[model samples]
Target: MTVDSGIQWRVGDALEPITLPPVTRLELIQYAGASGDFNPIHTIDAEAEKAGLPGVIAHGMLTMAKISRLFSPYLKYGWVRDFYTRFVGKVFVDDVIMIGASVAEKEEKGAETVYWFEVIAQNRKEEHVAVGELTFLV
Candidate 1:
């Protein structure tokens, strides 16, 4: 891919699917300690089960970060100008997350180009955990 020209061509029509490592209890605990998000549902199995979750769950942000990294190659060094998500379902331990993104549109209003994106994360059973839009300025 080339960058820094007067016009930046669309890098791709669709990105390769990104698959996250399986979610696990130890990973959740480490994420809690590292991120300071010590919610019981993410750290206590009983609390998660009582809350109708299968077990201590991974933080939503942890999953989001994984989704974010999937696009790093395309965005390069630029930060996402607009990024937002809707939580569709919970992710339990051992569930694998599959991330996918496609270009919805591209607009060139002036010197800057705006990439409208669609992204989703799903489990092996095809249940979506999170879905969202991200815009990048090119």
Candidate 2:
């Protein structure tokens, strides 16, 4: 959803949540090819199992990209100045991720207003797989 840039934002405001579809092996392969991240753990189940993982897992950067989609609306409106995240857990194939964010702080920087959001990426079990902060100039 697009957050209106003209609206007054506060420190406790909640950004809308974004629910992503399940990560599939085919998609992982595609991401691997496109991103040049040909890690067997993200594609070959045998390799992942040998590495002590349950099965083929998704790339951490892929999870970060999925979570970043939540900020696209703001980016499209030129409200986002910068964004980042840290991977805290592994995401496996068939796992569904949900991205959420909340306004942590807001302040005026010169003539611009800056908004800080605490972003989180969680799996179906509500376990956080990634977390970080985003800065936006609005």
Candidate 3:
């Protein structure tokens, strides 16, 4: 459904995609500091190399957070009831990610509407780095 003052929110409808700033090593370090997940693989090249990684990779939660940005515009209409993410690919420094969401199904219970959404985060190569389901109430 299309709201007069908002974007479409309906089953099988996709929200506009959002591209985020490129991932950088410094940003990784900042994320580690903020999230308190100071794993060296996300901030130290030597540690990542020792772990058989191409280089320091971005944190999975960071990627998940980036994916959530796709829902920012819709929050005014309702609120997210639940969100789950599965990390599929490594996100390296300099990689740009694009995120989007599509409504999968909806249910009406009493005075509330529940929406199930499919969310995705893809890298510059268009590979899915994170994908998830989100529940929203309107």
Candidate 4:
């Protein structure tokens, strides 16, 4: 949702996991078109392979967007102050990924409540493709 939403989250709340549909070159291209991150490694298979990747790969931002989708539904009306992430592995077309997150900690910073979050995206092989932390203002 929008940033001005109210706080309904708690320290131990768990978000329902989301399984991303199989990734595809078409999907990556669509995201590139939408986000304007037209990295050759994401759209050109040969370039990606020549760079030592298996094939054309999904954008890290695109994967992060999927992670964001998983968070938005549970956090409800949101106030995400900061999101920090790292791409641990490349995700290729046809890989099935699941996104999950849980509350890692909580703190009261004067008038704001900050929920520390841990997020992970795992492929069908159960490999962590991306790991992230998010801080939300409640």
Candidate 5:
């Protein structure tokens, strides 16, 4: 909570969790148009079946974007330097996403402080869909 100070970051502090509503085809379609990533597997059911998916699956980046929301409240105190993720599971239609991050480490870099966070996204079943590291420079 004390982000403006020179140094008082707790290495194991947990950010608030954000739970997003279930994924829907409409949202996926919209994301496709907006991102110009009209990948059929993310929208068309038939295409998803053709691609060996149970149904239209959510775009991996879409889930990544959800993970980024965990940093919104901290943006004013720092800028995101890097975000890395590994897609461990597929996101399907109607799957609710829960994103969370915990402070993994903190350090002072002369004038700026750096924070490393362990970020993760899980489905309603508590299965990990994404795991990653986030670097913030303050």
Candidate 6:
């Protein structure tokens, strides 16, 4: 989708899908350190096993960040008024995730235009990891 200054906005405009690199144990550890969320389920395989998880999982925020990156181009022109998501499934180490977004609605609100978007993230198995919405004012 083309995003230009003074461009027209339309419903159903979709951002290109962003395919993330395979999640790794090291990355989980780093995210845990950076976010101060050292939950064993996210960083330690043994602990995850004890918790009945198949393996170390990626942090929910980390997954959200990857998904939110799809909006970087839009954010340059508009401000995100609200962003939210529901964590629907686990994202484990080595999972390849893809983020996608489509404009669901657009309306003129006084001087500014408001855009509503549907954002979804899925793993290689086509399982939704997160489902969300984002609202932007441009």
Judging by TM-score against the true structure, name the best candidate.
5
lDDT of all predictions, in order shown? Answer: 0.82, 0.85, 0.88, 0.84, 0.90, 0.88
Q: After the best TM-score superposition of candidate 1, give how far the Cα of residue 10 lies from its true spot, in angstroms.
A: 4.3
Clash totals in order: 0, 0, 0, 0, 0, 0
Clashing pairs in 6: none
Q: Tens digit of lDDT per residue, candidate 1, span 1-138?
A: 886544343645677897878888898999889999989999898999899877787788988877787668756545578878888888888999999877888888776788877888899999999999888777
Pairs in clash, predicted candidate 3: none
Clashing pairs in 4: none
Which ten contiguous residues of candidate 3 have the minimum total lDDT? 1-10
TM-score for all predictions? 0.86, 0.88, 0.90, 0.85, 0.93, 0.92
How close to the true structure is residue 72 of candidate 5, measured as C-alpha lDDT? 80
lDDT tens per residue, model 3, 1-138: 775664446789887888888888889988898999999999999999999998899999999987777777778888888999999998999999999888999888997788899999999889999999998888
Task: State model 6's lDDT.
Answer: 0.88
Off by over 4 Å in 4: 1-10, 74-76, 109-111
lDDT of 4 at 50: 93
Kindly report the root-mean-square deviation of model 6 from the true structure over all alpha carbons: 3.0
- In lDDT terms, how accurate is model 5? 0.90
Query: All candidates: CA RMSD in angstroms?
Result: 2.9, 3.2, 3.1, 3.7, 2.8, 3.0
Task: Give a tens-digit lDDT track for model 5, residues 1-138.
Answer: 675553346899988899999899999999999899998999999999999988999889999988998888777777899999999999998999999999999988998889999999999889999999999898
Per-residue lDDT of 106 in model 6: 93
lDDT at position 119, candidate 1: 83
Residues 72-135, model 6: lDDT tens digits: 7767677888999999999988899999988999999898998998999999999999999988
